[model samples]
Target: MAYGEALALQRDLAQRRIDRSLDHDLLLLVEHPPVVTLGRGSHAEHLVAPKEFLAAKGVELFEVERGGDVTCHGPGQLVGYPIYDLTQHRRDLHWFLRALEECLIAALRDFGVAGERRDGYTGVWTGGRKIASIGIHVKQWVTWHGFALNVMTDLSLFDLIVPCGIPDVAMTSIQKELGERSPRDLWGRALDAVVLAFCEVFRQQAQMVELEAVRSGA
Candidate 1:
């Protein structure tokens, strides 16, 4: 889905959750076209590339309300937007963020990747290079705008911005680490791993709800 479309869906779901109309938490996994997003604390100078250059490369830019610095999203990146009610579990935001990092770390471990969390940072990293970026927002104790894991992403695109406002840090991907591996296959497996990890970490029963069922209020 497009980033805008996903954002709109998140808003709708968050509102439904706030109204107590949605009973189950949702994890939305999607791949977006090349785009750059600036979070609430993002500095404009972090965007190293010019607007014309970004436009020429078909990269869209949006200043978002999520908490973080500027970050890029594109094909081969697995973006997970978890619309969850913290009231059902723990209401502590710091614990929730750490849980998310742990969830990603566990998922990476399934693929033989050692993902770790850096001190004073909010992402999963390996060998000093970040593998995932996390930025979230909570409304009425419900969270949205979760994590972005670099699967087969083109790492060069990250050069356009000081990712998460961190300088001298590198962005790495699964494909980069596992050369000659099939990105399509790895992406599928990663999704499964993440879903399972999320369920286990949050203590929720996993259900595969069809989009049609969700739209129809079934």
Candidate 2:
């Protein structure tokens, strides 16, 4: 699905939480998209392209209500959607962001890429190029939208926007940074890192439940 649709689903999930209609414990999905998105509070000037140019390239540009500036998402990337009930955990955005960062940091470490959160920055970076981006929408203390780590994304699309409003911020991917295509079991290792990071950050054991469990009512 498109990033916009995914955002819409997040909004719906948030509303469900607010109304106390959501069921199940929590759910998460790892996916990849084919376009880029910029948050609503972000400046349009950060987008260096003319609308027609993006349209010609079959790239959809959208301004979303999430926090942070702009970032790209495309095939081969790993986008995480954690449909979590923050109320059940902690309702602190700082903690949530930190947990997400820890996930990327651990995931990258598995691939021998050091991912760190630069001071005053929100995403995970390696060397100087940003390898993962985090921006989310929270409603009534529940979070839906999450982070995207560049497993093997096409970095060219990021040139269309000054990512996170930072000038000359380099973008990199795992394939380029590691100088190797994803190993056959690369995703499994990344998933393990994600779950491990979540466990470490939240200080609680987590069970991987099916997406249908969340959709049934949550």
Candidate 3:
């Protein structure tokens, strides 16, 4: 889905959750066309490319309400937007963020990828190169705009911005770390692993429901 459409869906679902119309937490996985997003705290200088350059390259730019700085999303990147009600769990935001990092770390381990957490950072990293970027917004204690894991993404696109507001930092991916493996070949397994990890980390039962069913509130 495009970023705008996904953002709209997240808002709708988050409101439904707040109103008690939605009964379960949702984990939405999607691939976006090339786009760069600036968070609430992001600075304009973080965007290395000019507006015309971005336009010529067909990359959309958006300033969103999520936490963190500038980051890029594009094809081959696995973006997970988790609309979760924190009222059921602990109401602490820091705990929730760490739990998310742990969830991704556990999932990466399933693929034989060693995902690590930097002492003072908010994302999962490996060998000093970040493997995932996390930026979220919580409304009424319900969360949205979750993590983006680099799968088979074009790392060059990241050159357009100072990712996560960190300069001179490198971004790594599953494909880049493990050559001769296509992300498509492991996409299903990765998704399954992430869902299982999320369930275990959050202690929630994950039910696979179609988007149409959710939309219709079935």
Q: How far is candidate 3 from the true structure (C-alpha RMSD, Å)?
A: 1.3
Quantify all predictions' global Cα lDDT against the true fold.
0.90, 0.77, 0.91
Residues 115-209, model 1: lDDT tens digits: 99889999999878899999999988999999999988999999999999999888999888777754558989988999999988988878888
lDDT of 3 at 29: 86
**lDDT for each residue of candidate 2 in 1-218, tens digit (9 for 90 to 100):** 67676776677777787777874334465564556687865888898888788888888877777899877777877788776778888878998898889878987887888888899889999998888888887877777778887776788878888988888999997888877556777666766777777777667678766656555662
Off by over 4 Å in 1: 181-184
Output candidate 2 Cα RMSD.
2.2
Candidate 2, residue 111: the lDDT equals 80
Lowest lDDT 10-residue stretch of candidate 1: 209-218
For each candidate, how many residue pairs have backbone atoms clashing (under 3 Å)? 0, 0, 0
Cα lDDT for residue 7, model 3? 87
Candidate 3 has a TM-score of 0.96
lDDT of 3 by residue, 69-177 (tens): 9999999899999999999899999999999999999998888899999887799998889999999999999999999999888999999999999989899987887
Clashes of 3: 0
